[model samples]
Target: MLKLLALCLLTSLMYVQIAEAGIRYYKWEVKYEYKSPDCYKKLAITINGRTPGPTILAQKGDTVIVEVKNSLMLENLAIHWHGIRQIGSPWGDGTEGVTQCPIFPGDSFKYEFKVDN
Candidate 1:
């Protein structure tokens, strides 16, 4: 009986560990605006009106959800997740005119995918 109880406990611990595998979530809002990074003043497309867009930091096995908003007046926008191998999720690849359509001006799109290494 004692051996059976020990085995059950071990099984329960293993199940818990599997259930608690590293899983994370992130959200971002992307926009376009004009900005000048250097001394020269010029109009440049940016995220959230900033020169440099927000950086996303997540561990392996984490899931990210980014909501891109195209606030440009006369330009269509699309976000690309470069270097991210979106396994099992090809729709979130963000390839303009390829995986998805261009997000029209004043429109928004959500990108959901997992960061599996």
Candidate 2:
């Protein structure tokens, strides 16, 4: 009986550890100072610094913090978390001229928002 009880306690602790795991790091790079062939005008742009960003395992009520580092020549960048509710989370939405301005080149910004039900 003692052994069974000990096993159950260990299992419970492991489950909790898995559930509270932090968010995975995702890296991205936005490029500027380039004109499109058709447009012939330099504008804002984005490219995955590391191809295929890692898939983050997130759950409801989990606080997500996406650390973005801009290394462009000219122009700032921000991430707009789509499909996620931003009722009180304007920073994470990453809406230029709305929620928050883009981060300048060589600058870093940490977007924090909680996923709630």
Candidate 3:
């Protein structure tokens, strides 16, 4: 029993240490712009003024910090991390009216979370 207990405690400490080891940060800006996706000019929601937004590249156990700014004149915005597991940071889920309020036009919000895959 004593040996098992010591092993369990050591395993838990190792897990915690590994989780806190590799963390990276990032920032992104969301903006509204006019673009021609199919040769037709139209207003589109974009990140950094580009359609389709920017792709985030991170390894497991990394941290990301995205600073989103709503530049639209009349629209509210929120961002969601589709496949990233936000384990302990539920408020950064970006589900407007659920996890957090919508970011109004001309306003900004910062999302900080660690990626756990």
Candidate 4:
């Protein structure tokens, strides 16, 4: 709670350029399905009906808006940007219990963050 507050304060005091460059919107559906990447069929999480998911195209300083819908009947969903920094939007950081909470089943969460260095 304190960390969230401090992050919010720092972002507000600093220059926030989210959406200053441009805004890119994307809608993704999260669900579980049967997939085989190594010739073995197993249950796997797929985004938009794909195992690896779709590619997100963006440049530096651009704001990415992704609305993710969790279709899993008995699971929670949280998207963590592997190497991207969560700038100006820490609530959407997607670190589960750390930065944000999990999106419950049949629920949705909109992640809005800027692509920073």
Candidate 5:
């Protein structure tokens, strides 16, 4: 029993180490919202109902996975990485209608890419 307990503890430690080394994930929900960003109220595309959305904080050589859910009732949604260059994954280069099509309303799409320096 003691030996088994030690093995389990060691396995949990290794798992924690691997998880902290790399592999970051973010979940976002895209929807239309009306709010004042510049002191005026207008319809805007937001992630998780926030204007700017969530920011991804990761280091080079780390893997990032962002699962975006489109909640708009009448519009389609797509996300672009903007400036972050992908090293190996070219399909996720952030092109509209190219990265496996746009995420339709009430649908979910996962965008995964590796951070490159």
Candidate 6:
């Protein structure tokens, strides 16, 4: 019994450490709003959930993982990391419909990229 418990504890700790490796997270808020019948609010167009979204802080060479969660009902959204010189990494540039489509309501899209100095 003691050996089994020890093994379980060890395994759990290892799992947590492994999960923390090479993973960075960025969160964004999406408003369920509409201006027209087809057009929905965009990331760069919105400010930190307002008009311009928040500017995320990350170090060069760090792996960035952006998780965009949509709360609105509209479908097809996209976010772009404008002016981020990523050495031709397309995932970091959050361009909707170009790199990856926007996440729908209650949906999430994980955008991962490594920063370069």
Measured by TM-score, the strongest candidate is: 4
- The digit string of per-residue lDDT tens for model 3 on 58-106 reads 6666777787878878888888888876788888888889987999988
lDDT of 1 by residue, 25-79 (tens): 4444455445567767777777765667878777566777777777778887778
Per-residue lDDT tens digits for candidate 6, residues 1-117, read: 999999999999999765654546777767643233237543333423554466666666567777777766665567766666656567546666666566767787777777665
What tens digits encode model 5's per-residue C-alpha lDDT throughout 2-38?
Answer: 9999999999999986676588999999888898988
Q: Pick the candidate with the highest lDDT.
A: 4
Instruction: Please provide, for model 4 over 15-114, each residue's C-alpha lDDT reduced to its tens digit, 9 standing for 90 to 100.
Output: 5554356888999999999999899999999999998999898888777999999999998889998888887788887899999999999999999988
RMSD of each: 3.3, 5.2, 5.7, 11.9, 5.7, 10.0
Give candidate 4's TM-score.
0.77
Which portions of model 6 miss their true places by more than 4 Å?
Answer: 1-24, 32-50, 86-92
After the best TM-score superposition of candidate 5, give how far the Cα of residue 3 lies from its true spot, in angstroms. Answer: 32
In order, the Cα lDDT scores of the candidates are 0.75, 0.70, 0.80, 0.89, 0.83, 0.65
Off by over 4 Å in 3: 1-23
Tell me the TM-score of model 3: 0.75
Clashes of each: 0, 0, 0, 0, 0, 14
Considering TM-score, where higher is better, how would the candidates rank from best to worst? 4, 3, 5, 1, 2, 6
Task: Give the alpha carbon lDDT tens digit for every residue of 5-116 in model 2.
Answer: 9999999999997687556455555554444646665453545532234455677757777777787876677777777888677766888878788898899888777666
Ranked by lDDT from best down, the candidates are: 4, 5, 3, 1, 2, 6
Off by over 4 Å in 2: 1-48, 51-54
- Badly placed stretches (over 4 Å) of model 5 are 1-20
